[model samples]
Target: MEPRGVVLVAAGGMDGRGAMSVLYIYPGKMRGNGLDLVARQHLQALSEAGVKVECLARGAVSMPGITCRFLRHTPANALSFLPAAYYYGAQSRFFGAWACRLLDPGRHRLVVAFEGAAGRVFRRARASGVATALICPMGHVGASGSRAELAWPAIGEERLEEEYAAADRILVRSRRAAETFIQRGVREERMVVVPGGVDEEAFHPAQVRTPGPFRLLFCGRLSERKGIRQVVAAWKEAALSPEQAELWLAGSEPNEMKAWLDAACGAGVVRLGFVNDVASVMRQCDAQILLSEAEGMPKSLVEGACSGLATITTSEAGFPVQDGVTGWTVRREDSGGTARVIRQMADDVEAVRRMGASARQEALRHYTWAAFRKAFREGLLPLRQSAD
Candidate 1:
């Protein structure tokens, strides 16, 4: 049976139409970040499945067939922003609630909250008779390296816990993440593990490998928590001949780490600031390296797999690639070990090709957008029906 109404609240907005209109509320400005990409994919997939999607954001936005509303209120004056220290702490929640009431007067049958900040709004929606689900990316609750930029002393750990307890259902990206939520007191049955999907068409392997000095690519922010220093040390230890292999670091560098990165660059490390076409760069590289301290299933790993590049990441990445099967999973702090793996892949062209082939096969079989949509529908359909 069709759900009576459906709403999706997240930290990023979506733009598309579906059978049941989905309201997506994002916490920040719509940018080219990983969260934005995931939200876009969800909206696009839902639209393809014939569901209408609406988006709410604080800044610049565009959505087709879905309503795009920008809330103008600041968090300081907004009564709903909890603990009230954040710039938009109170206002975002109040405005979100108001927006929900305005857009969904009768209340949505199903409301999915995507981030911790959206929890209060979801609870309000539930109180108004909307069945709500909370969607949290893997590693969200865990204090990790990537969130340094987003950390808020005002929100605090207790507030995060309160939000988690309030959600009716929690959506996670991996088994590890689900475990984290369960440990936090969310019932096991209330948690759903749905990984982000990959764009196969855009990130597939080239018919032929691009010619270059065996390129080793790392595409993510250069933050200490991301293990950039570990990656650099590993690369240095691996000591691939300049003629044989070169390390390529792509994406923005944190301000605090700029001097360190500059020093590395002066010593011949190649760091390319954010690029428009990551796929093109992935195609040119032989392998993708990610030594993150933690992850909720990074898109880069899947992209690497789709592009037929061997991936060398930590266990936290949560990709299905097994050690020596599809790709390699190195210890988080073992830069020396990771470096050895990189050196081996750089030296053995045949091995790298074989691993790359396996990685692409895995991506095709398990990580496509269609597969993700199917899983998402299956996971949420029962709850949506029950709520109706």
Candidate 2:
């Protein structure tokens, strides 16, 4: 049976579009191999679901079912801005402005905008009798402009408000994220929770970690927001020699923390900036940690769980990792608490391994890409069709 409606997805990055007559618009260059593999995975999944996706990217994506539409002008960092918060909002707005020129609103029955980037596109889609869905797809948006600025730099208060007011439904990835939006005055009814998922084929447990030092990984950008400094502090407090325990830091190092990071690196911490093989890193490590101040079900945590590695995290880091079952969640910002947890793991390798196996099972049962796609596709259906 055919699905009810055709949708248009406008994202500054690769987001989602439905099956059959669905068009996906991207603001930047897309390659077969690049940093944005998550976006590529999404595109591939939608195509496999039989969506006729007209993809707007700079380069070629080798997907068999997708139709590539090369934008004459790629999304550029050609503008200057202040407070660093307006830069992304401005760029996203520009992308929508340029993209709207190419859109024929007569075609789509539904439209989805990602991270306030497609407010203009949503407006146009709504004008053509299409329902609009807005999604920030982040940890949280604060009541104050500065808080939103701190959380999502590319989306400013104005653009965020525009998106909030324009759409029929607002898609959030977690309950915490929905709460944040509600606090900002958006009704609970308008918010729909659709968490992100991992591609199991790429991230499933492929190899058992070899016997070595008690290895722990810290992925994602090395920034204060991700609790990099807190992890470093707790690791130092764990008081284990290099032979007994070691920490590996992946992703880009923050410029502001270079001095601290350099000193830590000299003390035997390995720094791998922007690792390409995240799954390999996860599979090889005994554990991982993400003690973020704010988060919306991080993909790294899911990947780690899928790779059969117990993740040491915090409640604020959100994503249902069962404490003492799949993994452990320490007190937020408590270096002592984190250190104690790490110390216990260091002593009992068997317990860590057991938790890792359980983590993989739980993730496999709940956090698959298939589930993400099913939820997203259902959201595309009209209210009547959905109720039916």
Candidate 3:
């Protein structure tokens, strides 16, 4: 492990510079995004653990012993929704496919990268007799079918499949994602399940619940897939007036949801777009809901749970939230079921607090960032390399 060298071709984040002679190839413009934050955390962990990392990011970031390089520039318009997939997909593909040419796999033990973004980088890595890996963060593309939650372009599917085929191993965040791949003909031995982790220190319980209206926090894109529209509908459907519950929508405001939101939330909704300090917001709320139709372990749920917010999530989210213990799980997206649960929680504030407390306490021991990093390192470290 000490002598091995690794090269990373990243379209998004998760800088894989660990205890090895590693080189990172990533978009320079990536910062302040969820994926960027994750990359920073893991990169820091790898450094603290004594891995020698060299980074080729688009922007300027200062780190000790980590060499930072630039990609000149890449045009990305976060505001344009219709062309977002094409723009970002092409950007990542260009960044990933060409980034690795600067990296010589003959000098590295491994070359790892995101699916679709890797372009021909993995093929080149394989040609050099290097072990190639792809971080398959999502489920299969065939299953996505224009689902709002998948968040990638259909055009990138062919490239992703090719990269998967080229990689020696493909990494996934949950057993659910692995199952999706296996069902799609990917070998079980080729997949690794490394669950998501929360930064417990950053998302701890509030010192005291602030005196305010009963609040339910909803963080993530306010789309149908995230169950935002459903939550709003249920809020009205449950007949719980604004005095009973307040919904805070934090994240980008999708144009498609604004019309329905006005009718459902009215004065009861609080919108905070692109919040820099999510932990503080979590402290102000009573509970969190992420009744997503599908997901690869929503980080917002984990962050909320770590912050002692009672989680009202769906089983499709892939987290083990107990029915009434750690948190409540809604089986259906129908407004009535959600409303009923909301009404019950609103009536019993103490129960919500208790469940929230349990969420953080259990997470600190089991789902914290420390836990994730340990699992991540174990899964990332190759057995053959470890024996060295």
Candidate 4:
């Protein structure tokens, strides 16, 4: 039996003629925010490039020339108590199983899935001789150093390895992310590095710098995984007076980190909890910092660069922060190194401006969605050929 809510949005073919369609599975809602926003862009990119896509999601998007199918609900609602990794893994596998029952090899040539959610679907597609692509939005689990302490248990390392093995192509967000897969024995040829994109117009530099202290922004979840503690420690160690420099944290403060964050608040950290206009915040700030221990290409850093703010990051953050050009790339958890970088940025505003200019140029050249769409279309060429 066919699943409900399967809308065949248009009668047109790929390029207005018959062509094998691609199956895109996202094991969650398409809510147009965060990961959902990224997924939405991927769908639009493929559709705009004249590829017919049949997307299976928990919720659907309204787009011309595409098929959108959605399940009424997912097990995730009941399993909310589980750890995030475990919850998502279970959801992915469940969605994969349901999608498999509806799989039509004659209609769909390839299957594209995100992360560990659709490993089951990858294996099934391979068995049916349909090529499969896996989009790993974050670094490989095996390479997730300190993050493994929390992530590895629910999302076991072996699960991702199996997914990687079954996938004909693996799309990663950075060269750093690709290296992690290579280290885990995935072939280099199978990898396609698609750095996450930013909206260049929406995040452009302020024509005039806002008048204030030398403000540095940290604009994501204030969690241990984000290395927020290290960022605060570094800011305190820099010893810049509150009037001279201020550290602004612009994301949700998790309950677990409240005590630490409260202490940091007294030492020049200003909580701008859950900002909706991050670009506007970026425009007002002198620099952006993210010292995450592991990531795919971080969207905040990319957007920061696009917004013409110098970025301070760790290499593991998966953003290609050209040391001293775009911003500083400090070692993860190295509070002393981060402190030195912070002090330098505070003392030398002119150099920071130069870095911000360079960063924006780099982002416009390489990190816009236009660049991502072109690269994505090219990456699909070989798969399309094989499917034909």
For lDDT, the strongest prediction is 4
C-alpha displacement of 241 in model 4, angstroms? 0.5
Question: How well is each residue in 1-388 modelled by candidate 1, as lDDT tens digits?
Answer: 1112223343234332324445566655556657766666655555555555456655434444445555434443434444334555444454445445544624356665556456556666667766666667746466543333444533445555665776667777877678766776678998888886888999988788777777888888787756788888888888777788888899888888998877665333688988789999888888888877656787788888899988888876666567887778888788788888988888887788789889999888888878887777667667766766
- What TM-score goes with each of the models? 0.81, 0.81, 0.83, 0.92
- lDDT string, candidate 3, 1-388, tens digits: 2111233342224354434355454543547655665556556655555555555555545445454555545443342355666666656666575556655553456655666566677777667676766766654445556534435542455666687788777777777777777888989988877677887778888898788778989998888778787777777776666777788888887887777766666767787876779999999998998878767788888889889989887877766687787778886566788888888888888899999989888778777767777765666566225322
Best by TM-score: 4
Per-candidate Cα lDDT values, in order, are 0.68, 0.69, 0.69, 0.81
Residue 376 deviation, candidate 1, in Å? 2.0
List model 4 lDDT by residue over 1-388, tens digit each: 6554444444343242234478888977888577787888888888787777778787777665567777746655567678786677677776777778766788788888886666677877888888888888866547655334545325566676788889888998888888888887788999998888888989999999889889999989998778898888888889999888999999999988898787676656889999999899999988999988878878888999999899999888899988889898898778888999999999988899899999999999999988887777777757866976
lDDT of 2: 0.69
Candidate 2 lDDT score at position 205: 69
- Kindly indicate the candidate among 2 and 4 with the higher lDDT: 4
Between candidates 3 and 4, name the one with more favorable lDDT: 4
Considering only N, C-alpha and C atoms within 3 Å, which residue pairs clash in candidate 2? 20-51, 89-154
TM-score of 4: 0.92
Q: What is the lDDT of residue 51 in candidate 2?
A: 51
Worst 10 residues of 3 by lDDT: 1-10
